[model samples]
Target chain A: MHELSIVFHIIKTIEQVGEENKLEHVNSVTLEVGEVSAVIDEYLGDCWKWAADRSELLKGARLVIEKLPAVTMCETCERTYATVQYGRICPYCGSERTYLLSGREINIKEIEVG
Target chain B: MQNNSIDVICAAAGSGRMEHFMKEVKILEIKKSVFEDNDREADALRGELHEKGIFLLNLMSSPGSGKTTTLLRTIEALKDRLKIAVMEADIDSDVDAHAIAGAGVKAIQLHTGGMCHLDAGMTRQGLEGLEAAEADLVVLENVGNLVCPAEFDTGAVKNAMILSVPEGHDKPLKYPLMFEVCDVVLINKIDVLPYFDFDLEKCREYVRMRNPEAEIIPICAKTGEGIDAWADWILREVAAWKADK
Candidate 1:
């Protein structure tokens, strides 16, 4: 699954940070995931639990996810709307010139250490 | 007096243990994107390729979409003019590599070990395995999937994907990211277009909607039709890439 690869990348990034900070143990990791990032939170958590425990630093570390809502900006109408509610087309002008404003992010915000 | 002082210090430590524990817990701020590392690696690899004057094309598509056949045709067409090599990536198979080697070119197979896609690091390893430094062009035949491969950059100079006639025209709409990332979309298996209800114009429109800059080339790899244009595209790209530096 793609989630497994994502988890592997996360571990690699965290390991680099751990080395730089000389961290003994990571208590938790907080992530800011977007609403339309195509990553299922449950699957990510499951994959994280299975893969994280294999690493010494991330073993038993809690995963906290913060969801960012999807918004689309209409180029023609210059109006923004919820992407989940109306996709691609602007509701005000029915124009197809629209692009995503956000909601595709997968970032590591912070880590709790002890 | 020493024994009374030791007792007082022990009582203080016992009462302050909770506060010390609380103080030990610290939050470290690290605001970073998950793809930042891979993207950096990919950019570095691109720079290295540019200095070496080698053009790398990352080819992606759904399974059974004629990716290997198109590669074979491409190699056959450009083998004499350019020093070309290939890296075939799959879950578990050396069949494609064997086929390419049989075509009289340097070829290597990369197993993803059950992973669906290859990242920049994996691509670099494959390039090293193929000893592709001497080659003018190296094509990375990425794992046959439309979704995961698009999300990961393989350090290629350009990305291309094949959408056969049988796969229908709505694929761009269904897999928007795949179409968006591709520099060119090869519409393969046009020989069977008469039998299927596939509309070429409609497909072009959909792809344009997703990516107006994407070049569409219709071809039938089996019949060797429209391959010259594809080969010419590569020729121009390789020349441009080498000349830009």
Candidate 2:
């Protein structure tokens, strides 16, 4: 799964930040995931466990994930709906042409350090 | 501030510590994208493509969507008329590279090593190795996936989506963004139309319902049916882009 590589990036980023700030360890890492993003949450958590276990900087650190739903803006009723459905359409207007307002995110929000 | 102030004097000192127990905690606010570096890298790559006048097309679909076949056919048809190059993304196999190498143009095979999609960072690396020296048309055949590839932008001018008849007409509805974001939609396997229940009109309507301006071209790459039309569409696009510059 691509989660492994993405997890590696997160690990590398944390280490870089740690090294720059002269921190000994990271307590927790948080991520905001977009609904359409191809990340499997459980897989990412499992992968993080394996990766964090071997490294001194991330030993036993908590992995937190927040999901962001794909926002479908209705052209007819002008309403927005949160949906994970692929080919997401506005629930109110039933418009297939709605713009996705948010979601599809993959980013580290913040890391708690000691 | 009293460190040992018990809320209820009736309870014991340790048991009356409701102030510490029910204390509200505030989270540190730091807004940042986990994919910030990736998106920034992709945006830079897009800038490069725009400057070079390279008509980059990130072709996507399932494993047997005729992705390599379509490129081969395109090379055979367009190499003489225009300069063409290919960047093929795969996990481990170089069979597609070997096949495309001798086809009479510069082709680079990028081994993703189990990566499902090609992000801008990897694509930028791949382009560094790719021969854009004697090339004008650049095509990136992504790792044949419908989900992951849709999330990342590889700095391509257009996302050429290959929808084979065997994949069913509902594919457009299922993979909506893939169909919606595509500049051109090529429906392959039209030669098998008689044996299958794939409705051409229904698919056109389906794509239009999502994106009205998207161009749909039905083709049978195996038999060369509608191949000229497909080639013509690509060439015309390249010409229009070149003229704009």
Candidate 3:
């Protein structure tokens, strides 16, 4: 699955951060996953566990995932609504002039080192 | 660093006394997007392709949605008029590449090794293999997936998606992200429109609801209907894309 590739990418990033920070070992990694993002959190965790364990800097590191809500901005109404509840049309003005504001993110929010 | 070492030593020495040792947990806020690296790479690739005046189109669709057929039709329409090449991506097998090659143009097969989607790096690799700089138009026929490919920008100048008539008109409702990111939506397989209960107007409405600016084109890839319009749209887009650069 692509989750493995993403896991590898994360590990590579974390390793670079570790090198720059002179981090001997990482305790945990926190990631913010958006509701509309294609990545599956459970699969990501599984992939991370499998890959992170092999890396010396990330050995036994716990992966934490925080879900971010999907939001959409209505251009016609100048208001925002939960994208998960409403597809694309603005619920307030019944307008199709809406764009996704956020929730497609897959951000590495924080890193805990020991 | 010295203070941490002393604290660790104290904690080990005062193992029996919990109150004697105080440890502080340190956390660094990264606040960095996981897609940051990919996005940066995609932007760089886009710049490189733009410098070469190559208009890259990322074509996505579900499996069996006539992506190859539509590509074949597109090649037939535009190959003689302009230089065209294809980077066909699939989980495995080069059947699509062979088909494109049969159409009498350069075709490079990208086997993802079971990856459902092609990332920016993968696309760059495919472009390198396809020798895209020599061609005026390079079409990246991404892996036949509606979900994963929608999330990744493949450094394409324009993103186009095909929704076949047999797939029903309600697909945008289920897969909103795919329709939302598309610059153009191609409604393919109109020749079989009479047999299926698929409504063209409803499909267009759904696409419009998700993406108001997306150009919707209905065509039958098998019969070559509405291909000239598609080719003209491409020509205009290519000119606009190059001119803007």
Candidate 4:
């Protein structure tokens, strides 16, 4: 539901970033969305095209989404790995505890403009 | 000689003006987020909330998701143990405050003047003149919505949501963030299960799919069924949070 609105914000930001760099038009935008950031990736992509097509500077801009896996740092081994299954336990060390490192990320990494 | 020189200068000026007007290039570069400026304010609000040891809870749900009822019950249950208060955000109504006050809790209402969602600055302002300054827990009953409220981060310590059984089990699938960002989930309206086709296990399953670690507590506000257990769970969380802070 918020996909279209978020896409609009992303497009607007891209335009500003492009203009700041003196670019004529945005060709592509790279957004790194964490697997656990509560954002629907497929829906985001769908909303991206519809929103980008309306803008003058960002019209037809490609939305490239980089899906990030949920990772946690092990308390015992101090190693980080994808949290494939449920539970905050470390995958390798089998420790009952671990800190969540990076999974909830919604970021605009870079933009390519002409 | 002076008249000839003046005539020549006027002709040159006219030609130059014409050249400047004909087919000049367009700059064609200006794009910016209408709300990018709001993001920084939102971040600052989050930091401020954390620094003050305020465990902020932004409660979101459908209109009839028992938000106010649950809050009234919560305030009644947890008042003595925790320094708690309520901030109600609405388009234009003071009814929520009246209801919260009826339950014997400090209440403040913020009218958005028709804005759909509550922003960080509005939240900070809403907190003013309230008795929650030394509060351990502060709850914000967000504008009754499943969409716009999910987008704005009111610098809350935790975002919680309610999904009444009558609203259906497919809600998590439809409104994922309301379930995803939630640190706790209260599956409200369980008393109507006999009259409706709502499933407790199924509802939990749906939420778990979106967010595995989400704690789900099923309760019926109208009948006071299972409210104590749910309330106990929340109070424990608040106690734990205060200790951590």
RMSD of 1: 7.7
* TM-score comparison, 1 vs 2, better candidate: 1
User: Taking the tens digit of each residue's C-alpha lDDT, what string does model 4 give over A1-114?
Assistant: 356656756765665555544557767777877677656888888888787888888888788888778787776898887765644556687874455577666666555544
Q: Residue B161 in model 4: shift from native, Å? A: 0.9
Q: How close is candidate 4 to the true structure, as a TM-score?
A: 0.62
Rank order (by DockQ, best first): 1, 3, 2, 4
What is the alpha-carbon interface RMSD for each candidate?
9.8, 12.3, 8.0, 13.2
lDDT of 1 by residue, A1-114 (tens): 488898998889888877755679999988999888868999999999999999999999999999989998888889999988887778999987777789988888777778
Runs with alpha carbons beyond 4 Å of true place in candidate 4? A1-114, B1-39, B129-131
lDDT of 4 by residue, B61-84 (tens): 889899999887787778888788
Residue pair clashes in candidate 1: none
Instruction: Tell me how far the alpha carbon of residue A38 in candidate 1 is from the true structure, in angstroms, after superposition.
Output: 2.8
Model 3: per-residue Cα lDDT over B1-245, one tens digit each: 12333232111112211112225445656667776677788899999988999999999999999999999999999988789999999888998999999999999999999888888999999998887677889999998888888877889989999999999999987788899889999999999999999988988888887888899999889999988999999999988878988
- Residue pairs clashing in model 2 are A107-B34, A108-B34
For candidate 1, the per-residue lDDT at B35 reads: 79
Q: After superposing candidate 1 on the true structure, give the runs of residues whose Cα lies further than 4 Å from its correct spot.
A: B1-22
The lDDT values for all models are 0.89, 0.78, 0.85, 0.72
Against the true structure, whose lDDT is highest? 1
Q: Which ten residues in a row have the lowest lDDT in candidate 1 chain A?
A: A14-23
Winner by TM-score: 1
